[model samples]
Target: MIKKFTLFLLLVLPISAFAQRFSQYFSSTMVESFENPAQGIFKPDTTKMMAFNFFVPNLSASAYTTGNATTTLKQYLFLHNSTFPNIYVGRNNFNTLSTNNNIYVGMFKMFADLAGKQEIGFSWQIRAEGTAHFTDETVQLFDGGTNFNNLQPYTNLFNDRYYAQGYHQFSFTYRETLSPKFSVGYKISALSGIAYDNTTINQSDIIFNKNQSDGTSALYLNLIGQHRTSYTPGSFAANNVVPNFKNPGLSVSFGVEQHNEDGVHIQYNIKDLGFIHWGSDPHIYNFNHTDTIGLSSGNAGQNVYNGASFITQQGGENKSFTTVTNGLAEISATKYFWLDGEKQFKYNPILVASKQLFYNGIAGAFINNVQYGKVTVGVMGTYDDLKQFNLGGKIMFKSANAEVFLGTEQLLTSYDMFRAHRGNLNYINSNANFTGAGIFFGFALKFGADVESPANASSIPMGEDEGFLKRTFKNIFGKKPKDYINSPGATSP
Candidate 1:
């Protein structure tokens, strides 16, 4: 009965979910600048020459889950699968799943020059990235032993993988405006790799032969290119809590923006095109095997590499390797519309297309942004390569010297879950699975006088008329939003 419930959940549940990637788009705080260095120069905050931001510990995270079966928090934590009826296993059924977590704390050390003709910015940060993937056949083999049904031949079914890394980055950015309509910017980063691990099953073919009368079974298998790396065993007695930064890497980012006199703007950004080179100390192993196992043989012992048994045979090597970092590329277009005669309320529609190159996911979204005075609110509808549609929202408050914001990608899912939980209804619906959710929030402090002499510098007057975007910059840098009309040489839309 437990097995039947597992199978039911696997076959019936919606299979895709991810974190709030779109929240950063409408987030107007200084912390958002770290996501893309080009944003550091956006609109040029003239009042702030320096800024600092800290992600409250355990408050910043991004995670995603993909699988053949979906499980809810209630079912996973409380319910017993044995309460269900007879199990039905589908033929030609193969399930593959992956979950990734990136826990990061950005001490957004940022510096900028707003009054200069050529804008310059710099930042340093630390990040920890981790990922894991597994296939249903791999789990079945572990749970049921040699009990696989002999109805069909299994080929390329051992699809499992994992990767984890920690690193620090120092980024330097520069931007220059060639004309009122066009500007270009670029950022280069030096990456200091702290630790790394990766594992994957490249290929597999297996067949099970079961004797009908005696209930005996034999297995024929061919598996190849199972690769892994580890740093905590044998000669590498590394620390359990501290990071090791013996490896290093480099990356570069570039962006371009085009804005018109009519308040229509387009921007593009390509980030983190780089690779990391691991050291020789970490054990890199590769395995390949072809063998037959009888039921009485008790199966060959596993644990090939990383001290975990992944193949029928332990076949691999120990060495060094290099891997490319998963980077991001995105493009967006935004246009502002006046909502009132006083220009105190405005509406902006935005379109963004983005890709995660390594994870192999593409996403597109349409966002509506509404700004009234120092507050901004946004709603977005997004679709990703996972075939998942998501709704997201964001709210922000900004002043001349400080800003704070919070947002989420699964607003609808969260709301529905709350309502269902209150009414005592089954939270797991048939159409959609809410396996994961995340929220992002942070505060920043920007302080620097616009003039060389501190005595001559005064806070920006509140009565000036400035566009919403410019007001955002001013508020971020400690300047008040204004109602300026057609300021001279104004480049931002």
Candidate 2:
């Protein structure tokens, strides 16, 4: 009777389900300068610049029974086969089904401008993330006999669980203007405070004793695990407890910006160039457990054991789990050109084009890392001489972003390619035909500063000294500066 009920649940339960993927959001204010670096390239009159941002993402997953009848039945039978008595084995046919959510908040500000040439900045960010999984299974059998003698076969099982994890980060950065045209900056980030929480409940039906009248039976089991690690709030020390590989990493970036007299701009930066260790040792969890037994008319139920154990077996057996230490790098270039000159009309339109390339590993993950390219085009225009608006689209040529990945899968079977190990798990190797496309929309507002700086400092007297200062600095710095004052025969003093 217990087996029959388990089968029924597997067949009748809703088969439509999906899996979630990682999603990231940057604070609108934190990203304000990302869109147009020119807007924030110079120190504002105010020494302090503060911004706040929030990000939220929703992910989900689901799987349904597949394969030949025998294969499916064999997989079904394995669930009832138990290697250890009292071991819990809830619904098993459904491969993957669950939803995960992640939220991130970041705050940043420029605290001080040293000697009006060097600026110091600081930022603090945190993330709250969690995942929940659900599954159900049931079996049914029928025996022939008179109404009073008839036997009702029963089988039912259900399990649900949730896992939660979080972390926090604090970073400091210093920017120094080596010359009027060239500058260098460095950032040191320290992260700490990691926590985890997990819970699970398993239910099944079984008969304790037979001989008397049939009686309904049920079993309930619950398991929970929680851990918290302490670390220095603003520094990484030997005693610090790292969170996950993805969460515990330090990064440094060196960037150069150059602007031509024609308003063309270019920038390059290498980020996540370092490694971080989350835990002193790897943690492994084994998920292979089963229960199997059959009831017959003339003998005790037959026992079937699969020798599969659930949860990682401790002692003598070691698993290697490490996070990526080498980080990726990015290079970007942009050009701005006038679309409409309104010296006569009072309003002007400008168009900007940018291209970016990202390689998973900078030092070298060449064969193992993934790389992609992207292009963006935008138009900026002033309306009524008081307001401005900008619109643009970015085309990517590589693996699809998380959003595109989940959306495309939603239109197909409930099974998630990554969860089922159906194909290459890496984004680069995933079924390319199915994953590759994302579109983003954005705009900006301007309130002050309208006088455009003369492209060539030749029009102003001090322009020559400024231009010479920038050129001489660039030569010494090995990188050109953006917006050099226009001047002929200008030489550094």
Candidate 3:
């Protein structure tokens, strides 16, 4: 029964989820520039004035599910078996699922000017984020009391939280080089919400009592906390998934890049630091702890959820609330060296450290790339504070006029999943640690006139152009003298 419920949830989601690909850093792809904010993507004479994906998606997707339930996931999702899953319950066993999805439906950029190497872009993206946290007993309660001992009480087994959201983002970005060693950029976005759902059980307990009449059991469940959703349960229609201003929000991202005196390039970025206010009319459920339900012979587990909702019918109709986006802060250092004597082959390495803004977690990664002319290949490894480790690689074909890249950022997890589906997977101690799978791919094209400094180009006139952000800054704070490193014509001043 737990297998069927979980499978239904997974099937309702998009086939591909998203994860960050560290190898894309310094690759000069459009997604990289948009993600990092301050990274430059144009060559003075080689790149075109305009670049776009031409409606082709520049997408990155990956996901991970950790904890003991994954063994059962391996069975239903992989082995295609009919075995009833047995979860480790009443012993504080737990499981978690984390996933993200980013799809760039449209992206367009052009070299706006030369001062500070200024560039501007416009983009439209559809994104989704989610996480699920639950104990093994939580699953056991849903399908029946097969894993529970009658006359015994399980404490806090129903404590869990599940939240998922998707939205559309329209953004405008600007980035400029302050000097050869310094650059800064920013992105401002307006978000239109598509869907939102969250449920939490902060404190809960359950007891199974033997039923003498039908040989089944009676469930005495005490539940606390609340549930929130934008639509009625089992009534999420096609229109509910469409973008509407009924729920609107905003977000911003910024990044800074610098070249240190030691020949290393350092970059710092803060992404998606904002929140969304859901529609005014939303369903909210606050659970009360006094509900005793009778378990049927077959569908006992699913009835638990129905019983919880029934207990909250009085408070389920309420106003909406606000939620913060998953924000990130990260720093990385990069250095390159010529691999051969002739200098035709170049090798670059980058080390990165990232933090979750709203949570207590961090991840560190190493990326190594070798470039020969227009082709490049690289490998990467990352470990998080939670002890999760991932290994992946990338291959790219990039020239001044175009770029294309594809790779698995979670190769080990993908391989493990593949092997499990083939019915030949094993763990050293019945523990797979973490299980996941994903891939990232993107392509972009460049055309039109050559991108050049507006002050030096015959096709562009400085008198006809002034940056929107620059003008706005001066208008709000008054004009100021330019710094030595910020002047357009002062290369060595």
Which candidate number would show the highest TM-score if scored against the true structure?
A: 3
Write model 2 residue lDDT over 1-493, tens digit each, in one string.
Answer: 3233224223222121111110101111223222111123233442223332222221222222321121222223334321221112332432222222212234233423323244344555443233333332211111111111222332333344444343454556555554444444555656543533333434333332234344422212112222222221224343333333333556454554454456544444543344344453334433333333333342111111111112112121223332222232433344433334632211112222211122111111000111122222222211111111111122212111111211221222223333323332332222222211112222212223322233522243232323333456668865444333335555532
Residue 463 displacement (Å), model 3? 5.5
TM-scores, each model vs. reference: 0.71, 0.37, 0.88
Q: Which candidate is the best by lDDT?
A: 3
Instruction: Give the CA lDDT, 0 to 100, for residue 290 in model 1.
Output: 64
Report the C-alpha lDDT of model 3 over 428-458, residue by residue, as the tens digit.
Answer: 1235647887878898998898876545567
TM-score pick, better of 2 and 3? 3
Candidate 3 ranges with C-alpha deviation above 4 Å: 8-18, 79-86, 289-298, 308-314, 422-430, 453-493
After superposition, candidate 2 runs with Cα above 4 Å error? 1-29, 32-104, 114-117, 127-166, 193-249, 280-322, 343-493
How much lDDT does candidate 1 score?
0.54
Q: What order do candidates take by lDDT, descending?
A: 3, 1, 2
